[model samples]
Structure formats: structure tokens, C-alpha cells
Target: MSLAARAVLVHRTTEYEELLARHGTHGQAAFFLAARGRSVEEVRERHERTSRALAEVTAAVPLKWRRAQVERADLDRFLFGPEDVVVVVGQDGLVANAAKYLTGQPVVGFDVDPGRNTGVLVRHRPADAHRLLPSVTGVRTAVDDLTMAEAVTDDGQRLLALNEVYVGAPGHQTARYTLQAPSGPAERQASSGVLVGTGTGATGWLRSLWHHHSSPLPLPAPTTPHLAWSVREAWPSPDSGTGHVAGLLAADETLRLVVESDRLVAFGDGMESDALELTWGQSVRVGVAEGALRLVG
Candidate 1:
């Protein structure tokens, strides 16, 4: 790491703020919560805990290095330096949200509710950030480079995913597409969607899908370099086939999908808000990303 390197903190909007944004007013937000037998105080408490965690993280970064902070929703607008050390202060999922925008910058994930969190990605606690921040920049420190998944459209729009990428109809309606693996013949299919998950994501959505399989398959480790692709709820029909429902994408291979429907969408790490849209006759290639997350625990 360079002496001029800085710390970039990735923050997420609290649940209360989201409710306020959705309702347009505090009173309306509170009423909606009350109807669900919840209270504003509960949301406020959660926000307060996150606030204190952020304060700890903010104070822990060295004053010699410049600091930058951005909310998860505004990640695309932020400019990350090559020497920046990214700090994610939220749940584990927030770390995944930040990973897509980063290009090999060392990431330190701190769990806001450490005691309650059983997450694998966000391993550090709020109180330990002070010690962890310096370690990430230490000369002798080594970080793990975790594999990431990606989706590239025929027209060249690309998206990186730290966990998994969902490719399918916007509303998850039956997806009509032709799936082609590196060495297999293309097969038309109708399904809810296709999920391409990295090794780190196997413990997440991929795990649930794995549980449904009659014969269990080996789930990848966090640092596995390949991607696992699966079709969700495939339905075999006159025009659709299911022979190519699951496969592994080696680092050098591409899993291609030719769209046969009116429209299909692709999004990474469950963030549907930022997605790529594909129309009929379009194609999307799924593969391992060249830029992986350099994570420090």
C-alpha cells in the first residue's frame, strides 16, 4: 500500500430512512410501522447502533490518510482511488453491495450488530476496526483475493457481482432463453431465472438451491475461482428444454444465454434497483470477473 492511500467508508441508509423515503413523511412512516405491530422506536434503536458503529470506524482511520464516505445507493457516483482501502460499515450484504463498484481495493467489512451477526463476509466488529484499519495497510499484511462473478451483454454492458447475479425476466416471470455452456449445445428453457454465484455466495442463495437437489453437490469455498450457475424452477414445455439446468463456469469459460423473450434483466448481489435490461434476440455471457475483492479480516 502507498503512503498516500486513503480509507473509503461504505455506508448504507438505515431502515428508518428507507421507510421515511417510501412514505414521504415521518408520521406516515410511523403509521405504516404501527399497522405492522412495530414502532418507530425499534427502527430508531437499530439506526442508533449503526450510527455509533460508524462513529467508531470514522475515528479509527489514520488522520495522515484522507478519508472518503459514500452511501451504498450512491456508490456509482463516487470515485475510488487505486490506493484506497475500503471500509464497509453495515451488515454482510452491504459489503457485497460495495464490492461490485470496487476494483481490487482492500475491503474491511465490519458488522454493525456483531453479536447477532453470523455472517461470513463481514467478519470484523465495530470496536476492532481501529486495529484492523492499520493492519490492512501494513507492509507485511497479506489479504485474500476472493473470486467474483460477472455478466456481460452482447452490446458490451457489464456488471460484477461479489455474491451472485440473477439473469431473468424483470419480475421473475418465466424466462424464455437459450442456455449454452462452453462445450454444450444450446438449449431453450423456461424458468423463473438463472443464478450465477461465486464461491463466496455458495453459503447464501446457492445454499438454499443446493438443499433442494436430490444429490448434494460440493459447494465452493469463499476463495473458489469458478462460478456455479443454476436455473431456478425450470419448466419443460414444447419449445423449452431443461437438459442444461446446472453447470459450473470455469474461470476461462463463458455461460451464454440467448434471449427468446420480450425482455430479461440481470442484476448482481440482489440489488434489483441497478440492473441491466435485455430484449429479445439479445445475449448475455456469464463468467468470472477479472477484478476480485481483496479482503482483509
Candidate 2:
């Protein structure tokens, strides 16, 4: 028998929820925020908005469809099926948080608090769910296939990120590795870390890095099947070279790195908890992921 379509609502825990968990009561949470010159009321209001939006989206799911909900914290443990339609109701980051776990699933993003969020990814609202759901599930709506970055370790571990991937030491210490660009001779280097990002990530950390240093390569457009990579704070020494610091990667190309340090980590979309660890001499390849984010309007 064919599997039934499922609507998976994904969201992150609001600040109000975290405050309550930390302080144990509304009054205590309020007091904690007050001491920091912030208002708990504002946090509570945002939480309520997200909660209401989630409820509306959940109710909008077709009666014949199966439904499931996964918080951002539990995404690593959640299982996403091929017949699932993901509905993300939160800020743009929440959408990125769920993207790595999905494989060509049609994603509907809702910006619950448009005034506060930039809403680049979560462009729709709760009320639009009623109209959008049918088109999405029917595969009749226009979907933007946003490019993503992928990192694969030699041992067969793989990670995908909608925004970008960071490969380096777990903490502040500098990471040592051999750098090899798509079309260049490999060179040994010691530096902070390496970052590889997709066009969907151009406006984020990649932009910040670009601002400090100029590059000949152009940043990819949101749906472009390309990647941009850079080495952060590459240290120059007689034993290390900085010639291969930054470059652009074509869809068919990849940037390679062989870890020279005791240990290194590869993480996507800023979720450090769900990361792949690499030891010395292990090689990692960063490139464009084959699957794109099927973002539904």
C-alpha cells in the first residue's frame, strides 16, 4: 500500500519556554529578564503568536493526512519520510534547522512574527496555510529549489546545511589542515577553520567574511547550484601557506581538506550539537549537495 501524506510541523522552543524552564515560574522569569533590561511580556507575546500560528497550521492539514510535530531540539532524533510535507512556523533560522533533515520534501514556511523576523525563508503567514497546503501537496505550486552545502568525511559520515558548513576545531583554538581547492595544488595550512556556504547563505556569515576580504569569485544567487568557500584567519608560517584562502566552487567541483590537528568538527546551519567529528589524517570533502530545498510558497 502507498504511504499516506504527512504534515510535519517544525518549530523551535520560544524564549518564554526557555525562561520558564530556567526560572521555574512566570514571576521568576520576568524578574530575570527585568534584571537584564529586557521584558518577559514581549517574549511571552512572541511565544503566544508562534503557538497560535502552529495551531492554525496544524488545523489546516487535510483530514486524510497524517500529522507529526517536531521541535528544533528534537530534530536530530526525528525521522522524516518521503511522503511528508514540512511546515515550519518560526523565524528563518528554524527553517534552516529543518532543511538538513529533509530530502526534497515540500517545505511551507510561516513567519509567525513578521515584524520581528526578516522572513527571507518564512515568507508566508498562518492564514495562507489553508490556500497553500493543497497546491503544495498536489505538486502544482511553484517551489524554489534552494541550493545547499554538504560535507562528507572519509569514514562515510555526511552532513548537510541550508546556510553553510563550518569545519574546524570545536572551540576557539586554531585548526590545522591541508587545503585543496577545486582546481589547484594542495597546500598545508594552519588557521582558524574553513567555511563553505551556498547561495541561500550568501547574506549570512559568508557575507560577513566577504566584507573583510575581497574575492574574485561572485557569490551565488539563492537558487544557484554553486558554493563559495573561505579559510578563516589563515596563519602564515614557513610550514604553512595562505595562497589558497578563498574561492568559488562549481556544482561539479569540491574543496578537499585533510585534518592535521588532533581533532576537528563539521557542522551545518549553526547546530553544533549535531556534528561529525574527524580525527587526524581524515579527509573531508565540501561541495554542493545533490538535493535542493523544495521551498513551497
lDDT (0 to 1) per candidate: 0.88, 0.91
Question: Which tens-of-lDDT digit does each residue in 82-131 have in candidate 1?
Answer: 89999989988988998998887889988998767775778888899778
The list of candidate 2 runs beyond 4 A from truth reads: none
Clash counts for the predictions, in order: 0, 0
Worst 10 residues of 2 by lDDT: 131-140
Clashes of 2: 0
- Which candidate has the top score in TM-score? 2
- For all predictions, the C-alpha RMSD in Å is 2.0, 1.1
RMSD of 2: 1.1
Residue-level lDDT tens digits of model 2 in 4-37: 8999999889989999999999999999999999
Q: What does the lDDT read for residue 278 in candidate 2?
A: 92
**Candidate 1 Cα errors over 4 Å, as ranges:** 1-3, 20-31
Clash pairs, model 2 backbone: none
